[model samples]
Target: MVKTPLFKSLPSRDRTAAKKLVAPAVIGIWIVILFPLLYALYVSFHDWILSQGKIGEVNFSNYITVLKDPLLLNAAKNTILLTVSVVVLEIAIGFGLALLLNNKRIRLRNLYLFILLVPMLMPPITVGLIWRLLLHPDLGIINYMLSLVGLPQPIWLADPVLAMITIIIVDVWHETSFIILVLLAGLTSLPDEMYEAAMIDGASAWQKFKFVTLPLMAPTILVATIIRMIAALKTYDLVYILTRGGPGISTETISYYIYKVFFVFLDMGKSSAMAFILLAIIILMTLILMRVMRTAEQ
Candidate 1:
Protein backbone atom coordinates (compact mmCIF):
# COMPACT_ATOMS: atom_id res chain seq x y z
CA MET A 1 0.00 0.00 0.00
CA VAL A 2 1.13 3.59 -0.67
CA LYS A 3 2.28 5.43 2.44
CA THR A 4 -0.44 7.66 3.88
CA PRO A 5 0.39 11.35 4.33
CA LEU A 6 1.08 12.55 7.90
CA PHE A 7 -1.78 15.08 7.41
CA LYS A 8 -4.25 12.17 7.18
CA SER A 9 -3.21 10.98 10.63
CA LEU A 10 -3.44 14.54 11.92
CA PRO A 11 -7.05 14.71 10.63
CA SER A 12 -7.96 11.57 12.57
CA ARG A 13 -6.39 12.94 15.69
CA ASP A 14 -8.32 16.20 15.31
CA ARG A 15 -11.52 14.28 14.86
CA THR A 16 -10.87 12.34 18.04
CA ALA A 17 -10.19 15.54 19.94
CA ALA A 18 -13.35 17.11 18.59
CA LYS A 19 -15.36 14.12 19.75
CA LYS A 20 -13.75 14.29 23.14
CA LEU A 21 -14.67 17.95 23.48
CA VAL A 22 -18.27 17.36 22.36
CA ALA A 23 -18.90 14.15 24.33
CA PRO A 24 -19.55 15.85 27.65
CA ALA A 25 -22.07 18.26 26.14
CA VAL A 26 -23.86 15.39 24.37
CA ILE A 27 -24.06 13.38 27.58
CA GLY A 28 -25.27 16.39 29.52
CA ILE A 29 -27.99 17.02 26.96
CA TRP A 30 -29.14 13.41 27.25
CA ILE A 31 -29.28 13.70 31.00
CA VAL A 32 -30.99 17.10 31.18
CA ILE A 33 -33.22 17.13 28.11
CA LEU A 34 -33.56 13.77 26.39
CA PHE A 35 -34.02 11.79 29.58
CA PRO A 36 -36.98 13.87 30.73
CA LEU A 37 -38.56 13.73 27.29
CA LEU A 38 -38.25 9.94 27.25
CA TYR A 39 -39.70 9.68 30.73
CA ALA A 40 -42.62 11.90 29.76
CA LEU A 41 -43.21 9.76 26.69
CA TYR A 42 -43.25 6.65 28.82
CA VAL A 43 -45.59 8.18 31.36
CA SER A 44 -47.88 9.46 28.61
CA PHE A 45 -48.87 5.93 27.63
CA HIS A 46 -49.51 4.79 31.17
CA ASP A 47 -52.50 5.51 33.38
CA TRP A 48 -50.60 7.69 35.80
CA ILE A 49 -52.40 9.85 38.32
CA LEU A 50 -51.20 12.05 41.13
CA SER A 51 -53.81 10.80 43.52
CA GLN A 52 -53.22 7.16 42.56
CA GLY A 53 -49.51 7.55 43.34
CA LYS A 54 -48.59 4.75 40.95
CA ILE A 55 -48.17 4.15 37.27
CA GLY A 56 -50.97 1.93 35.99
CA GLU A 57 -51.18 -0.18 32.83
CA VAL A 58 -49.64 1.24 29.65
CA ASN A 59 -51.95 1.85 26.74
CA PHE A 60 -53.29 4.55 24.37
CA SER A 61 -56.29 5.38 26.50
CA ASN A 62 -54.83 8.70 27.66
CA TYR A 63 -54.20 9.83 24.09
CA ILE A 64 -57.60 8.55 23.01
CA THR A 65 -59.33 10.44 25.77
CA VAL A 66 -57.38 13.64 25.03
CA LEU A 67 -58.27 13.43 21.35
CA LYS A 68 -61.94 12.94 22.12
CA ASP A 69 -62.09 15.73 24.69
CA PRO A 70 -64.02 18.72 23.34
CA LEU A 71 -62.21 21.09 25.69
CA LEU A 72 -58.86 20.00 24.34
CA LEU A 73 -60.11 20.45 20.81
CA ASN A 74 -61.23 23.96 21.60
CA ALA A 75 -57.94 24.72 23.29
CA ALA A 76 -56.02 23.50 20.25
CA LYS A 77 -58.10 25.65 17.95
CA ASN A 78 -57.57 28.69 20.13
CA THR A 79 -53.83 28.05 20.24
CA ILE A 80 -53.59 27.87 16.46
CA LEU A 81 -55.59 31.03 16.06
CA LEU A 82 -53.53 32.88 18.64
CA THR A 83 -50.22 31.72 17.21
CA VAL A 84 -51.10 32.74 13.67
CA SER A 85 -52.61 36.07 14.59
CA VAL A 86 -49.84 37.05 16.98
CA VAL A 87 -47.06 36.06 14.56
CA VAL A 88 -48.60 37.94 11.68
CA LEU A 89 -49.26 41.06 13.70
CA GLU A 90 -45.84 40.94 15.34
CA ILE A 91 -44.13 40.66 11.96
CA ALA A 92 -46.06 43.57 10.54
CA ILE A 93 -45.56 45.86 13.50
CA GLY A 94 -41.97 44.85 14.07
CA PHE A 95 -40.99 45.28 10.44
CA GLY A 96 -42.59 48.67 10.40
CA LEU A 97 -40.73 49.71 13.53
CA ALA A 98 -37.46 48.35 12.13
CA LEU A 99 -37.96 50.29 8.95
CA LEU A 100 -38.63 53.43 10.91
CA LEU A 101 -35.52 52.96 12.97
CA ASN A 102 -33.46 52.29 9.87
CA ASN A 103 -34.47 55.64 8.41
CA LYS A 104 -31.44 57.91 7.97
CA ARG A 105 -33.48 61.00 8.85
CA ILE A 106 -34.65 59.68 12.20
CA ARG A 107 -33.18 61.27 15.32
CA LEU A 108 -32.49 59.38 18.56
CA ARG A 109 -32.95 56.05 16.76
CA ASN A 110 -31.00 54.17 19.41
CA LEU A 111 -33.07 55.66 22.19
CA TYR A 112 -36.29 54.70 20.46
CA LEU A 113 -34.99 51.21 19.85
CA PHE A 114 -34.04 50.90 23.51
CA ILE A 115 -37.47 52.05 24.62
CA LEU A 116 -39.16 49.48 22.38
CA LEU A 117 -36.95 46.71 23.70
CA VAL A 118 -37.85 47.48 27.32
CA PRO A 119 -41.17 45.67 27.04
CA MET A 120 -39.46 42.51 25.83
CA LEU A 121 -36.97 42.63 28.67
CA MET A 122 -39.75 42.63 31.20
CA PRO A 123 -40.78 39.27 32.65
CA PRO A 124 -43.99 37.93 31.21
CA ILE A 125 -45.65 37.82 34.60
CA THR A 126 -44.69 41.43 35.28
CA VAL A 127 -45.95 42.54 31.88
CA GLY A 128 -49.18 40.68 32.52
CA LEU A 129 -49.61 42.32 35.89
CA ILE A 130 -49.00 45.77 34.45
CA TRP A 131 -51.44 45.20 31.62
CA ARG A 132 -53.97 43.70 34.00
CA LEU A 133 -54.03 46.93 35.95
CA LEU A 134 -54.33 48.95 32.77
CA LEU A 135 -57.05 46.69 31.43
CA HIS A 136 -59.10 46.73 34.59
CA PRO A 137 -62.61 47.84 33.61
CA ASP A 138 -63.26 49.95 36.64
CA LEU A 139 -60.07 51.90 37.39
CA GLY A 140 -57.79 51.05 34.47
CA ILE A 141 -55.87 53.84 32.80
CA ILE A 142 -56.85 52.45 29.38
CA ASN A 143 -60.55 52.90 30.03
CA TYR A 144 -59.87 56.27 31.54
CA MET A 145 -58.04 57.33 28.40
CA LEU A 146 -60.88 56.00 26.27
CA SER A 147 -63.31 58.00 28.35
CA LEU A 148 -61.15 61.08 27.82
CA VAL A 149 -61.47 60.46 24.07
CA GLY A 150 -65.22 59.99 24.45
CA LEU A 151 -65.03 56.34 23.43
CA PRO A 152 -66.95 53.50 25.03
CA GLN A 153 -64.96 51.28 27.36
CA PRO A 154 -65.61 47.67 26.53
CA ILE A 155 -64.86 44.91 28.98
CA TRP A 156 -61.41 43.94 27.79
CA LEU A 157 -60.98 40.61 29.57
CA ALA A 158 -64.54 39.68 30.31
CA ASP A 159 -65.78 39.54 26.72
CA PRO A 160 -64.71 36.40 24.86
CA VAL A 161 -63.74 38.13 21.64
CA LEU A 162 -62.15 41.01 23.48
CA ALA A 163 -60.30 38.64 25.81
CA MET A 164 -58.64 36.91 22.87
CA ILE A 165 -57.88 40.26 21.31
CA THR A 166 -56.40 41.52 24.58
CA ILE A 167 -54.14 38.50 24.85
CA ILE A 168 -52.96 38.99 21.28
CA ILE A 169 -52.31 42.64 21.92
CA VAL A 170 -50.37 41.90 25.08
CA ASP A 171 -48.32 39.23 23.33
CA VAL A 172 -47.55 41.51 20.45
CA TRP A 173 -46.43 44.27 22.76
CA HIS A 174 -44.09 41.97 24.64
CA GLU A 175 -42.63 40.02 21.69
CA THR A 176 -42.53 42.43 18.76
CA SER A 177 -39.21 43.73 20.05
CA PHE A 178 -37.67 40.34 19.21
CA ILE A 179 -38.78 40.59 15.60
CA ILE A 180 -37.71 44.20 15.42
CA LEU A 181 -34.23 43.34 16.65
CA VAL A 182 -33.79 40.45 14.21
CA LEU A 183 -35.10 42.40 11.20
CA LEU A 184 -33.03 45.45 12.09
CA ALA A 185 -29.91 43.32 12.26
CA GLY A 186 -30.74 41.81 8.88
CA LEU A 187 -31.33 45.29 7.48
CA THR A 188 -28.10 46.57 8.89
CA SER A 189 -26.11 43.65 7.48
CA LEU A 190 -27.55 43.97 3.96
CA PRO A 191 -24.88 45.05 1.47
CA ASP A 192 -25.30 48.73 0.56
CA GLU A 193 -24.05 47.90 -2.96
CA MET A 194 -27.29 46.03 -3.67
CA TYR A 195 -29.35 49.15 -2.95
CA GLU A 196 -26.99 51.23 -5.09
CA ALA A 197 -27.34 48.74 -7.93
CA ALA A 198 -31.13 48.87 -7.63
CA MET A 199 -30.97 52.66 -7.66
CA ILE A 200 -28.77 52.59 -10.77
CA ASP A 201 -31.44 50.42 -12.41
CA GLY A 202 -34.00 53.18 -11.58
CA ALA A 203 -35.82 50.96 -9.07
CA SER A 204 -38.36 52.80 -6.89
CA ALA A 205 -38.41 52.48 -3.09
CA TRP A 206 -41.23 49.93 -3.18
CA GLN A 207 -39.55 47.95 -5.95
CA LYS A 208 -36.21 47.82 -4.10
CA PHE A 209 -37.89 46.62 -0.92
CA LYS A 210 -40.16 44.15 -2.73
CA PHE A 211 -37.42 42.51 -4.75
CA VAL A 212 -34.22 43.09 -2.78
CA THR A 213 -34.96 43.71 0.85
CA LEU A 214 -37.60 41.00 1.25
CA PRO A 215 -35.68 38.20 -0.47
CA LEU A 216 -32.54 38.84 1.54
CA MET A 217 -34.45 39.20 4.79
CA ALA A 218 -36.53 36.09 4.21
CA PRO A 219 -34.40 33.84 6.41
CA THR A 220 -34.39 36.29 9.29
CA ILE A 221 -38.12 36.78 8.98
CA LEU A 222 -38.68 33.03 9.01
CA VAL A 223 -36.56 32.66 12.14
CA ALA A 224 -38.43 35.40 13.99
CA THR A 225 -41.79 34.03 12.86
CA ILE A 226 -40.97 30.48 13.96
CA ILE A 227 -39.72 31.64 17.37
CA ARG A 228 -42.76 33.81 17.97
CA MET A 229 -45.09 31.11 16.70
CA ILE A 230 -43.68 28.54 19.12
CA ALA A 231 -43.79 31.01 22.01
CA ALA A 232 -47.37 31.94 21.19
CA LEU A 233 -48.33 28.28 20.96
CA LYS A 234 -46.97 27.69 24.44
CA THR A 235 -48.29 30.92 25.96
CA TYR A 236 -49.26 30.50 29.60
CA ASP A 237 -47.77 33.01 32.02
CA LEU A 238 -49.52 36.09 30.67
CA VAL A 239 -52.74 34.21 30.06
CA TYR A 240 -52.62 32.74 33.49
CA ILE A 241 -52.03 36.10 35.16
CA LEU A 242 -54.38 38.19 33.02
CA THR A 243 -57.43 36.07 32.35
CA ARG A 244 -56.55 32.66 33.78
CA GLY A 245 -58.18 31.19 30.64
CA GLY A 246 -61.29 32.98 31.67
CA PRO A 247 -64.12 34.52 29.65
CA GLY A 248 -65.13 30.87 29.07
CA ILE A 249 -61.82 29.59 27.72
CA SER A 250 -61.63 32.10 24.89
CA THR A 251 -58.00 32.89 25.69
CA GLU A 252 -57.08 29.38 26.83
CA THR A 253 -54.30 27.99 24.66
CA ILE A 254 -53.42 24.28 24.68
CA SER A 255 -50.57 24.80 27.12
CA TYR A 256 -52.82 26.41 29.68
CA TYR A 257 -55.34 23.65 29.19
CA ILE A 258 -52.65 21.07 29.78
CA TYR A 259 -51.65 22.87 32.97
CA LYS A 260 -55.25 22.76 34.19
CA VAL A 261 -55.45 19.09 33.40
CA PHE A 262 -52.18 18.29 35.08
CA PHE A 263 -52.54 20.40 38.20
CA VAL A 264 -56.22 21.20 38.58
CA PHE A 265 -57.63 17.89 37.43
CA LEU A 266 -54.53 15.94 38.58
CA ASP A 267 -54.81 13.80 35.45
CA MET A 268 -51.12 13.13 34.98
CA GLY A 269 -51.56 10.57 32.20
CA LYS A 270 -53.89 12.72 30.11
CA SER A 271 -51.76 15.81 30.74
CA SER A 272 -48.61 14.03 29.61
CA ALA A 273 -50.45 12.76 26.53
CA MET A 274 -51.58 16.32 25.78
CA ALA A 275 -48.06 17.58 26.37
CA PHE A 276 -46.71 15.05 23.86
CA ILE A 277 -49.32 16.07 21.32
CA LEU A 278 -48.35 19.70 21.80
CA LEU A 279 -44.72 18.74 21.35
CA ALA A 280 -45.53 16.92 18.14
CA ILE A 281 -47.46 19.90 16.83
CA ILE A 282 -44.58 22.23 17.66
CA ILE A 283 -42.10 19.89 15.95
CA LEU A 284 -44.29 19.69 12.89
CA MET A 285 -44.56 23.45 12.73
CA THR A 286 -40.78 23.78 13.13
CA LEU A 287 -40.19 21.33 10.26
CA ILE A 288 -42.65 23.18 8.04
CA LEU A 289 -40.95 26.47 8.85
CA MET A 290 -37.54 24.98 8.08
CA ARG A 291 -38.83 23.74 4.72
CA VAL A 292 -40.16 27.18 3.92
CA MET A 293 -36.87 28.74 4.96
CA ARG A 294 -35.01 26.32 2.64
CA THR A 295 -37.30 27.26 -0.22
CA ALA A 296 -36.70 30.90 0.48
CA GLU A 297 -32.95 30.30 0.52
CA GLN A 298 -33.17 28.57 -2.82
Candidate 2:
Protein backbone atom coordinates (compact mmCIF):
# COMPACT_ATOMS: atom_id res chain seq x y z
CA MET A 1 0.00 0.00 0.00
CA VAL A 2 1.18 3.52 -0.76
CA LYS A 3 1.62 5.91 2.13
CA THR A 4 -0.20 9.25 2.16
CA PRO A 5 1.79 12.51 2.18
CA LEU A 6 1.84 14.32 5.50
CA PHE A 7 -0.21 17.29 4.33
CA LYS A 8 -2.65 15.03 2.55
CA SER A 9 -3.00 12.89 5.62
CA LEU A 10 -4.23 15.85 7.66
CA PRO A 11 -7.99 16.29 7.88
CA SER A 12 -9.40 18.97 5.61
CA ARG A 13 -10.95 20.77 8.56
CA ASP A 14 -7.65 20.79 10.42
CA ARG A 15 -5.86 22.14 7.34
CA THR A 16 -8.44 24.88 7.04
CA ALA A 17 -8.01 25.72 10.71
CA ALA A 18 -4.21 25.84 10.34
CA LYS A 19 -4.50 28.18 7.36
CA LYS A 20 -6.83 30.45 9.31
CA LEU A 21 -4.31 30.56 12.16
CA VAL A 22 -1.42 31.41 9.80
CA ALA A 23 -3.31 33.94 7.66
CA PRO A 24 -2.84 36.89 10.03
CA ALA A 25 0.93 36.42 10.24
CA VAL A 26 1.23 36.03 6.46
CA ILE A 27 -0.87 39.12 5.83
CA GLY A 28 1.03 41.11 8.45
CA ILE A 29 4.38 40.19 6.87
CA TRP A 30 3.20 41.23 3.42
CA ILE A 31 1.84 44.53 4.70
CA VAL A 32 4.82 45.39 6.88
CA ILE A 33 7.78 43.95 4.95
CA LEU A 34 6.92 42.84 1.43
CA PHE A 35 4.82 45.87 0.51
CA PRO A 36 7.58 48.37 1.40
CA LEU A 37 10.20 46.29 -0.36
CA LEU A 38 8.05 46.10 -3.49
CA TYR A 39 7.40 49.82 -3.31
CA ALA A 40 11.10 50.53 -3.00
CA LEU A 41 11.79 48.37 -6.04
CA TYR A 42 9.19 50.35 -7.93
CA VAL A 43 10.63 53.67 -6.79
CA SER A 44 14.13 52.56 -7.75
CA PHE A 45 13.18 52.49 -11.41
CA HIS A 46 12.00 56.09 -11.50
CA ASP A 47 13.57 59.51 -11.12
CA TRP A 48 11.96 60.50 -7.84
CA ILE A 49 12.20 63.77 -5.93
CA LEU A 50 10.97 64.35 -2.40
CA SER A 51 10.50 68.13 -2.24
CA GLN A 52 8.72 68.31 -5.61
CA GLY A 53 6.74 65.10 -4.92
CA LYS A 54 7.39 64.03 -8.46
CA ILE A 55 8.36 60.63 -9.84
CA GLY A 56 9.74 61.12 -13.32
CA GLU A 57 9.94 58.60 -16.15
CA VAL A 58 10.38 54.97 -15.10
CA ASN A 59 13.64 53.55 -16.41
CA PHE A 60 16.97 51.99 -15.42
CA SER A 61 18.78 55.33 -15.50
CA ASN A 62 18.78 55.64 -11.73
CA TYR A 63 20.69 52.38 -11.36
CA ILE A 64 23.13 53.41 -14.06
CA THR A 65 23.73 56.76 -12.37
CA VAL A 66 24.28 55.14 -8.98
CA LEU A 67 26.68 52.56 -10.41
CA LYS A 68 28.76 55.26 -12.09
CA ASP A 69 28.90 57.57 -9.05
CA PRO A 70 32.40 57.97 -7.58
CA LEU A 71 31.10 58.39 -4.05
CA LEU A 72 29.19 55.11 -4.26
CA LEU A 73 32.32 53.35 -5.52
CA ASN A 74 34.39 54.71 -2.65
CA ALA A 75 31.73 53.83 -0.13
CA ALA A 76 31.50 50.29 -1.49
CA LYS A 77 35.24 49.82 -1.18
CA ASN A 78 35.35 51.21 2.34
CA THR A 79 32.38 49.04 3.37
CA ILE A 80 34.07 45.85 2.16
CA LEU A 81 37.31 46.73 3.91
CA LEU A 82 35.54 47.57 7.16
CA THR A 83 33.40 44.42 7.12
CA VAL A 84 36.37 42.10 6.52
CA SER A 85 38.62 43.74 9.09
CA VAL A 86 36.04 43.87 11.86
CA VAL A 87 34.70 40.34 11.32
CA VAL A 88 38.17 38.75 11.33
CA LEU A 89 39.39 40.62 14.39
CA GLU A 90 36.17 40.02 16.29
CA ILE A 91 36.30 36.28 15.61
CA ALA A 92 39.88 35.96 16.76
CA ILE A 93 39.50 38.02 19.89
CA GLY A 94 36.09 36.60 20.81
CA PHE A 95 37.27 33.03 20.37
CA GLY A 96 40.29 33.68 22.54
CA LEU A 97 38.11 35.21 25.24
CA ALA A 98 35.67 32.33 25.04
CA LEU A 99 38.48 29.84 25.42
CA LEU A 100 39.75 31.68 28.46
CA LEU A 101 36.31 31.84 30.01
CA ASN A 102 35.64 28.18 29.24
CA ASN A 103 38.46 27.23 31.54
CA LYS A 104 37.30 25.27 34.57
CA ARG A 105 39.91 26.86 36.83
CA ILE A 106 39.03 30.47 35.93
CA ARG A 107 37.83 32.48 38.95
CA LEU A 108 35.03 35.04 38.80
CA ARG A 109 34.16 33.95 35.27
CA ASN A 110 30.61 35.36 35.50
CA LEU A 111 31.89 38.77 36.56
CA TYR A 112 34.40 38.83 33.75
CA LEU A 113 31.73 37.77 31.27
CA PHE A 114 29.42 40.55 32.45
CA ILE A 115 32.19 43.13 32.11
CA LEU A 116 33.02 41.93 28.62
CA LEU A 117 29.37 42.26 27.59
CA VAL A 118 29.06 45.90 28.67
CA PRO A 119 30.07 47.28 25.31
CA MET A 120 27.54 45.18 23.42
CA LEU A 121 24.79 46.28 25.78
CA MET A 122 25.31 49.96 25.01
CA PRO A 123 23.47 51.51 22.04
CA PRO A 124 25.56 51.81 18.89
CA ILE A 125 25.19 55.59 18.83
CA THR A 126 26.16 55.82 22.50
CA VAL A 127 29.20 53.62 21.92
CA GLY A 128 30.22 55.83 19.01
CA LEU A 129 29.82 58.95 21.10
CA ILE A 130 31.82 57.50 23.98
CA TRP A 131 34.62 56.39 21.67
CA ARG A 132 34.57 59.79 19.98
CA LEU A 133 35.20 61.48 23.32
CA LEU A 134 37.85 58.92 24.26
CA LEU A 135 39.71 59.35 20.95
CA HIS A 136 39.55 63.17 20.88
CA PRO A 137 42.97 64.37 19.79
CA ASP A 138 44.07 67.15 22.14
CA LEU A 139 42.03 66.73 25.30
CA GLY A 140 41.08 63.04 25.11
CA ILE A 141 42.34 60.40 27.54
CA ILE A 142 43.80 58.36 24.68
CA ASN A 143 46.03 61.22 23.51
CA TYR A 144 46.89 62.12 27.09
CA MET A 145 48.05 58.53 27.70
CA LEU A 146 50.08 58.64 24.49
CA SER A 147 51.70 61.87 25.68
CA LEU A 148 52.53 60.30 29.05
CA VAL A 149 54.11 57.35 27.23
CA GLY A 150 56.28 59.70 25.16
CA LEU A 151 54.31 58.98 21.96
CA PRO A 152 53.25 61.56 19.42
CA GLN A 153 49.48 61.99 19.16
CA PRO A 154 48.03 61.23 15.78
CA ILE A 155 44.68 62.54 14.65
CA TRP A 156 42.44 59.45 14.60
CA LEU A 157 39.33 60.69 12.78
CA ALA A 158 41.15 63.29 10.70
CA ASP A 159 43.57 61.23 8.58
CA PRO A 160 42.02 58.87 6.04
CA VAL A 161 43.91 55.68 6.87
CA LEU A 162 43.94 56.36 10.60
CA ALA A 163 40.25 57.24 10.48
CA MET A 164 39.44 53.89 8.95
CA ILE A 165 41.65 52.14 11.50
CA THR A 166 40.00 53.98 14.36
CA ILE A 167 36.55 53.03 13.16
CA ILE A 168 37.59 49.41 12.75
CA ILE A 169 39.07 49.37 16.27
CA VAL A 170 35.94 50.91 17.74
CA ASP A 171 33.74 48.46 15.84
CA VAL A 172 35.79 45.51 17.02
CA TRP A 173 35.69 46.70 20.62
CA HIS A 174 31.93 47.19 20.56
CA GLU A 175 30.95 44.08 18.59
CA THR A 176 33.44 41.48 19.79
CA SER A 177 31.34 40.88 22.85
CA PHE A 178 28.57 39.40 20.71
CA ILE A 179 30.98 36.91 19.21
CA ILE A 180 32.32 36.01 22.63
CA LEU A 181 28.81 35.40 23.95
CA VAL A 182 27.86 33.21 20.99
CA LEU A 183 31.10 31.24 21.03
CA LEU A 184 30.98 30.80 24.79
CA ALA A 185 27.46 29.37 24.54
CA GLY A 186 28.58 27.05 21.77
CA LEU A 187 31.60 25.97 23.80
CA THR A 188 29.48 25.34 26.84
CA SER A 189 26.98 23.20 24.92
CA LEU A 190 29.67 20.96 23.40
CA PRO A 191 29.84 17.45 24.82
CA ASP A 192 32.78 16.68 27.08
CA GLU A 193 33.13 13.04 26.04
CA MET A 194 34.97 14.00 22.86
CA TYR A 195 37.58 15.95 24.84
CA GLU A 196 37.93 13.11 27.32
CA ALA A 197 38.43 10.67 24.49
CA ALA A 198 41.01 12.96 22.91
CA MET A 199 42.81 13.23 26.20
CA ILE A 200 42.79 9.43 26.59
CA ASP A 201 44.38 9.24 23.16
CA GLY A 202 47.12 11.65 24.35
CA ALA A 203 46.04 14.56 22.18
CA SER A 204 47.69 17.90 22.90
CA ALA A 205 45.64 21.01 23.68
CA TRP A 206 46.10 22.45 20.21
CA GLN A 207 45.42 19.07 18.66
CA LYS A 208 42.17 18.74 20.56
CA PHE A 209 41.06 22.18 19.51
CA LYS A 210 42.02 21.50 15.92
CA PHE A 211 40.55 18.01 15.62
CA VAL A 212 37.62 18.20 18.02
CA THR A 213 36.53 21.68 19.03
CA LEU A 214 36.67 23.36 15.62
CA PRO A 215 34.60 20.72 13.89
CA LEU A 216 31.87 21.01 16.50
CA MET A 217 32.04 24.79 16.57
CA ALA A 218 31.93 25.32 12.80
CA PRO A 219 28.20 26.06 12.68
CA THR A 220 28.41 28.49 15.58
CA ILE A 221 31.34 30.31 14.01
CA LEU A 222 29.52 30.62 10.69
CA VAL A 223 26.43 32.01 12.44
CA ALA A 224 28.45 34.56 14.41
CA THR A 225 30.41 35.57 11.29
CA ILE A 226 27.23 36.05 9.27
CA ILE A 227 25.60 38.16 11.99
CA ARG A 228 28.68 40.35 12.38
CA MET A 229 29.17 40.68 8.62
CA ILE A 230 25.61 41.91 8.11
CA ALA A 231 25.99 44.44 10.94
CA ALA A 232 29.34 45.64 9.61
CA LEU A 233 28.03 46.01 6.09
CA LYS A 234 25.24 48.29 7.26
CA THR A 235 27.39 50.25 9.71
CA TYR A 236 26.34 53.91 9.74
CA ASP A 237 25.78 55.11 13.29
CA LEU A 238 29.38 54.72 14.39
CA VAL A 239 30.73 56.30 11.24
CA TYR A 240 28.16 59.04 11.42
CA ILE A 241 28.72 60.01 15.04
CA LEU A 242 32.49 59.44 15.10
CA THR A 243 33.51 61.03 11.79
CA ARG A 244 30.31 62.06 9.95
CA GLY A 245 31.89 60.55 6.84
CA GLY A 246 34.45 63.32 6.90
CA PRO A 247 38.23 63.29 6.52
CA GLY A 248 37.57 63.41 2.76
CA ILE A 249 34.81 60.76 2.95
CA SER A 250 37.44 58.16 3.78
CA THR A 251 35.35 56.36 6.36
CA GLU A 252 32.01 56.62 4.59
CA THR A 253 30.24 53.26 4.31
CA ILE A 254 27.56 52.26 1.82
CA SER A 255 24.75 52.87 4.28
CA TYR A 256 26.14 56.29 5.20
CA TYR A 257 26.49 57.14 1.52
CA ILE A 258 22.89 56.12 0.96
CA TYR A 259 21.84 58.39 3.82
CA LYS A 260 23.80 61.28 2.31
CA VAL A 261 22.25 60.74 -1.09
CA PHE A 262 18.76 60.59 0.32
CA PHE A 263 18.96 63.39 2.86
CA VAL A 264 21.98 65.54 2.07
CA PHE A 265 21.86 65.42 -1.70
CA LEU A 266 18.09 64.85 -1.70
CA ASP A 267 18.33 62.36 -4.57
CA MET A 268 15.60 59.85 -3.82
CA GLY A 269 15.77 57.84 -7.05
CA LYS A 270 19.49 57.24 -6.89
CA SER A 271 19.39 56.50 -3.19
CA SER A 272 16.60 53.98 -3.65
CA ALA A 273 18.56 52.28 -6.43
CA MET A 274 21.63 52.15 -4.23
CA ALA A 275 19.59 50.77 -1.35
CA PHE A 276 18.25 47.97 -3.57
CA ILE A 277 21.74 47.19 -4.78
CA LEU A 278 22.99 46.99 -1.19
CA LEU A 279 20.08 44.72 -0.30
CA ALA A 280 20.99 42.46 -3.20
CA ILE A 281 24.60 42.30 -2.15
CA ILE A 282 23.64 41.45 1.42
CA ILE A 283 21.20 38.76 0.27
CA LEU A 284 23.85 37.28 -2.01
CA MET A 285 26.41 37.18 0.77
CA THR A 286 23.94 35.59 3.16
CA LEU A 287 23.03 32.91 0.60
CA ILE A 288 26.69 32.11 -0.09
CA LEU A 289 27.48 31.84 3.61
CA MET A 290 24.45 29.65 4.23
CA ARG A 291 25.43 27.39 1.32
CA VAL A 292 28.95 27.05 2.67
CA MET A 293 27.66 26.20 6.11
CA ARG A 294 25.31 23.58 4.70
CA THR A 295 28.14 22.05 2.69
CA ALA A 296 30.31 21.94 5.78
CA GLU A 297 27.57 20.27 7.73
CA GLN A 298 27.09 17.67 5.01
In model 1, what is the error at residue 248, expressed in angstroms? 2.0
Q: State the weakest 10-residue window (summed lDDT) of model 2.
A: 3-12
lDDT of 2 by residue, 144-240 (tens): 9999999999988899999999999999999999999999999999999999999999999999999999999999999999999988889999999
Would you list the C-alpha lDDT of every candidate in the order shown? 0.91, 0.93
Model 1 spans with C-alpha error above 4 angstroms: 1-20
TM-score of 1: 0.92
lDDT of 1 by residue, 56-101 (tens): 8887788888899999999999999999999999999999999899
The positional error of residue 151 in candidate 1, measured at the CA in angstroms, is: 1.7
Q: Which ten residues in a row have the lowest lDDT in candidate 1?
A: 4-13
Query: Alpha-carbon error at 158 in model 2, in Å?
Result: 0.9
Best by TM-score: 2
